[model samples]
Target: MKKEFMKNSLYVMIIICVIGFIIIFSSGAIGKSMQYNYLQKYENAVPSNQLERYLNDITSNFRTAGQVISTLGGFGILLCGYAHYKEL
Candidate 1:
């Protein structure tokens, strides 16, 4: 039962990521709001502090995720080819 719960949570995470990826991929308002919010929070704190650094780290993770989308997209294409090749 614990394994099943973990599987469901993972599925939910993947779906959420896909939705976030789509929204961010389009360069939409969600991305804008997130950026703005981060900027505001960073500015409210003291300059050259840990909070600012942490926010930068979070944004970098988002950028890394964009890179992953491309990697996954290519892998998905390769999977399609393999499926087709096996069908013959």
Candidate 2:
């Protein structure tokens, strides 16, 4: 049961990683800004409007949260696999 749960967790993490990649790449323009992340703030300063700022802030927060959850999911899968491995 633990083995099966970890296996499913790995697959879910992989799918989330793919979705994150899509968000990080699917902007309309090569340099278009959709998220005003702390790192992104200085880089994507061209679109300095209220709407863009709001969009950036919101997306940045959500994306960052998504990334954190994805990372946790990955770690969880790895730890579970390692535990199962040790039991073998």
Candidate 3:
């Protein structure tokens, strides 16, 4: 029963990792589109330099989030793989 639980947990971790991978792949384009929309919405209200900086910061934050997610997923997958190997 414990072994079955462990195996199931590992499978769940793998699925989460795949979801993280998908987020990492999609975030960039999503960020770009969001940034563009934000800029367009505030075209005249904000100065170009300030708006650009803000948009850059937003994009950077999104990228950082993606990186962190990817790192966690990678680590989780690696740990599960090691556990599986050791079990065998």
Candidate 4:
């Protein structure tokens, strides 16, 4: 039934939100740790080596992507819920 589908959708969305939170937090922590490690090693110098630059760029991109996904997923969930509610 539509109600069951809606409930299932909500449940899935809840799980997705939790996953998003984990992704955001873990990515952020990893990024910060990488930055700190670089600073400690280089005495506040920017990443001069190719490997360091690549790692920093990848981590930064992942963190940004995780945050954006989390936000968009949450909004999508809200919209889905609203749409389902109106249907009911």
Reference-based lDDT, each prediction: 0.57, 0.60, 0.75, 0.74
Q: TM-score of each candidate? A: 0.42, 0.50, 0.70, 0.62
**Backbone Cα, N, C clashes tallied per candidate:** 0, 1, 0, 0
Model 3 residue runs over 4 Å out of place are 32-43
Better of 2 and 4 by lDDT: 4
Once superposed on the true structure, which residue ranges of model 2 sit more than 4 Å away at CA?
1-48
Cα lDDT of model 2 by residue, 4-65, tens digit: 87678768767776665555444333223444343366664554475466665666666666
Per-residue lDDT of 36-57 in model 1, one digit per residue for the tens?
6766876866455555465556
Clashing pairs in 3: none
lDDT per residue for candidate 4 within 15-86, as digits (tens), equals: 777777787678757776777776778776564575467566868787777777777768878977997879
Pairs of colliding residues, candidate 1: none
What overall lDDT, based on C-alpha atoms, would model 1 receive against the true structure? 0.57
With a 3 Å backbone cut-off (N, CA, C), the pairs that clash in candidate 2 are 36-56
- For 1-88, candidate 3 gives per-residue lDDT tens digits of 7679777877777777777677667766767787778777877576778766766777677767777777777787788778878888
Who is ahead in lDDT, 2 or 3? 3
Worst 10 residues of 3 by lDDT: 19-28
Q: Give the best candidate by TM-score.
A: 3
